[model samples]
Target: MATDSASACIRQTERFGAHNYQPLPVVIASGQGAWVLDVEGRRYLDCLAAYSALNFGHRHPALVAAAHAQLDRLTLTSRAFHNDRLGEFMERLATLAGTQMVLPMNTGAEAVESAIKVARTWGYRVKGVPTDRARIIVAANNFHGRTTTIVGFSSDPGARDGFGPFTPGFDTVLYGDAEALAAAITPETVAVLIEPIQGEAGVILPPEGYLAQVRRLTAEHGVLFIADEIQSGLGRTGATFECDNAGVRPDLYLLGKALGGGIVPVSAVVGESSVLGVLRPGEHGSTFGGNPLAAAVGIAVVDLLETGEYQSRARELGAVLGRRLEELVGAGVQSVRVRGMWAGVDIDPDLATGHRVCELLAERGVLAKETHGSTIRLAPPLVITAEEIDWAIDQLREVLAELS
Candidate 1:
């Protein structure tokens, strides 16, 4: 009965919804822990976790409780007036990231956009870059967000083409190449914005010493190092921030995704007062950026991370994941990249595309997504058990064997 209902729902969405995303044929109705139940009443292990927004998993007890408690009291109080929850949220989040200030926003793109504004402003005021000549160095295959200004600097044609009239002041350099990045920097460069791990580029890790080199170069050049940790932060990479794994810290940390605790859209730009303090009262603002509900959820998320249990779990399971995935190389997987509990499995292109592999995995009760062409990313909730991890890997093994 529910499966029939799912077809109707899909048809209705196709009729009314914008054809922006081509989602897999599964109508998820509800989720808990690391699993989601579709409208058809079938369960699927959630491997993507809404791209890490659900890092704590859907309906996490603490986060949901925070949302519910805040809902009963207060929800929205724009930046015009001080909300009770905003101060605590900002303080806690800033402290968690080891920053002195926080600029609350509602989405990942907004956080990135805000960071860009701050960097550009800091350049003119603090770094003394020529007016409107401030340049930000970005990687080649970066996926910051879909905003026009963000996509303007994108190397991926899929995200850049047809979105013309892009904003300037950004230079693209080859990713994971310290030499290229160092060569790209100029006197006008204000910041070097990069992801510690390129999530959208199939969890691409930098060369062993690339991040430390970037840190040194940025500091020596007197340019701000902005780490966009939206997808790679919040215990996703076995640490509070992926930068920790590299033993480097960016001047500005652009954070989101798990910050909202899968309950609300909460994002923030955290940095020292010297950099983030450049913003004046009316310089930058967002109406729905720091609502009470979002603050409550974010505060709860910080509290959860403060325990360090989730980070430990990611490290423990990540080892199991790495061992299992490494075994699959040359069998059906061309290559595998595992960091913490996150993985990017490159399926043999001759056997199937990443999309086809995801479809087969979905049929087998595992949910993942394709990146590039033949790479599929697996980022399940940190709460996932060893048994569940093994199960998902087994499903992938079966899918690849069948296709081969």
Candidate 2:
């Protein structure tokens, strides 16, 4: 919506809100399937899908049903009392992840924090690393979250600027360099954390064979390999994991984004029993971590991903989107990156800006978000039909052509 109320709301945000993000002017009020209805009653195809959390598409009936049923029974038990749905959620999630233990949390960042804690504790209790010396290594161009410790290793200046004095114990290296990771790990290093595909860094994928090499090297070094799959996991990448494409497995997985089925915020650290078991009684926890409402929705999400059709939908559509975007190289596009149903299109800066293009896209009934600079990321719901995807792509093509 770009009406009086919409401008008023935007002005309110500008006045009272932290100016962290420069969002477009459109104001949305409702969504169904892959389409969001702005306050002005304009229906836009949601290409960002809330950064993949709406992978099941906005307001899937089955997931909404699950949320409703859970709300009628119980919502939060807070670990002081056990929730009925937590165990089932953990079991389904662990099975889907091929792991033995699942430690639940509420946000992707909190899940990441939990993974760091688990790694350090596992180093001390199991791997015999010295106390308080355990270190975790991350990559450049990484966006784990905005937590103080997570931002400590961030390579992006805007993310980390003025946020210091930062936390110690995190080392940084290049994104796709396995050798850099090997060299950076000291004896004090307990975990080498990575994203299978760096989403926030313009959808940067690692060099082929890099993941497998890291998997092997981490094993050889007696260091745990931790994966932050918040933005890339749960079939967003066609496979259950983007790491699976390289036939690699990490010791620990930090999962979020799509796990709550877009109904709630739920995340988890799934790992081997010994690794996740490091958290002792009262050592760490969250108020909404294993709450019953989230657990129910999470179980439903796992069930949704288990279907073969869902993964195949992402794979088949991702290829179509990739080919169309690659053709943009001849159509004034600077570059294109595609993995699963996700794509990062780098528009030519000389012609028009990413922000301007996005504003125009919003006007023409498509919604994508800009990342880094000069790049707009497109990740529609996997539930989208081939026809819907083609329609969205045609809209993008028309818009880009008009910009010429």
Candidate 3:
């Protein structure tokens, strides 16, 4: 239950704001590391990490300092005149992603939209696909973003309902099925866009060797394999990219979420010059895309990943998280899937819904969210310690026992 202070804030916001999201009743005031303070002064372990946007945890010192220093100097130049920070930020980010070019944007959805345009344009300019007929293949149940174009390609009805007439020329295929993907490809297919690990679809991991097969199939068909790493990239997956773990490189890397170090909204489509170079000036751009403030924070974020400290933490602590979660499979969890520090635990539907489990976890001072009605995802910040992971899992265990 929410206290008067928290209830007032929730009520005021719901009364005025749009009802697009049904967030838990707790109102957070401040955060540091893996913990947050609610309006009523209660503390909770943040298991969702703002859906992996807070991978570095909240207000990281280096990121905050970088933001402050940038604030004292320059902010935005609207991409009209080149900003000093843009080039360096792009260069470093490209180097980190192992790509030749970076097209900066402000959100994951924009990055997806931008990549779609790039792939389509490349098909026309380089691949010699007939104009306006280029098609991109996407996996079912994918959640790239809420953009109309992105939603149009999504298999989820809730996201697509009443949103379209959606943009056309997208082919849908079953995820983790190489045969379906191969069958979907044609001369008009320009790119294969997929999340390396499906985050919003209950943190689903593809079948073993599935990513490599996608790479192989796309290469044989001369289609660009665009990995939407917006949620699975950075240090959250215990590797710079989830693709890296599979030893398969995609043609384009769509990055966001943690790229801003939880400071600002930063996203980009990273690819070789052959692909991204197809975009001419004024064709696609964002005014606030490569602003100085975002660049400074992005540079700091790259600096952090360069050290590989967070990735190591995620790998080491993720093992601990996976083991604890597996113990509950027979208790109330029907199944569990884990990769690095990310997990999706499917609560037994007969026991309770994922939403109810999350509400109980919140009451016990742990924060988590559900997806697809019955699965709860755990993606605590990479900064979270082993002890904190134990405590959070303990809370879930108790909650399951109570439900049982």
List, residue by residue over 1-404, the lDDT tens digit for candidate 2: 47997888889989999988888888889999898887778788999999989989999998999999999998888998887799999999999988899999999999999888899998999998988999998888899999988887898898898898888999998988988898998888899999989998888888989999889989998999998889899888898888787798899988998999999999999989978888899999998899999999998988888886777888999998898788778586889989989888999888688887888888788899888668889999998877877788787788789999
- Candidate lDDT values, in order: 0.94, 0.88, 0.95
Model 3: pairs clashing at backbone N, Cα or C within 3 Å = none
Model 3 C-alpha lDDT versus the unseen true structure? 0.95
User: What lDDT tens digits, residue by residue, belong to model 1 across residues 64-162?
Assistant: 999999999999878899999999999999889888999999899999999999999999999999899999999999999999999999999999999
For candidate 1, what is the TM-score? 0.99
lDDT of 3 by residue, 1-404 (tens): 89999899998999999999999989999999999999878999999998999999999999999999999999999999999999999999999988899999999999999999999999999999998999999999999999999999989999999999999999999989999999999999999999999999999999999999999999998999999999999988889999999999999999999999888999999989989999888999999999999999999999999999988988999999999999998999999999999999999999999999999999999999999998999999998999999999999999999998
After TM-score superposition, the amount by which residue 161's alpha carbon in candidate 2 deviates from its true location, in angstroms, is: 0.6
| Cα shift from native, residue 77, model 3 (Å) | 0.6
What's the C-alpha lDDT at position 122 in model 1? 97
**Candidate numbers sorted by lDDT from highest down:** 3, 1, 2
Residue 348 miss distance in model 1 (angstroms): 0.5
Query: In model 1, which runs have C-alpha deviations exceeding 4 angstroms?
Result: none
| Clash pairs (backbone) in predicted model 2 | 1-27
Task: Point to the candidate with the largest lDDT.
Answer: 3
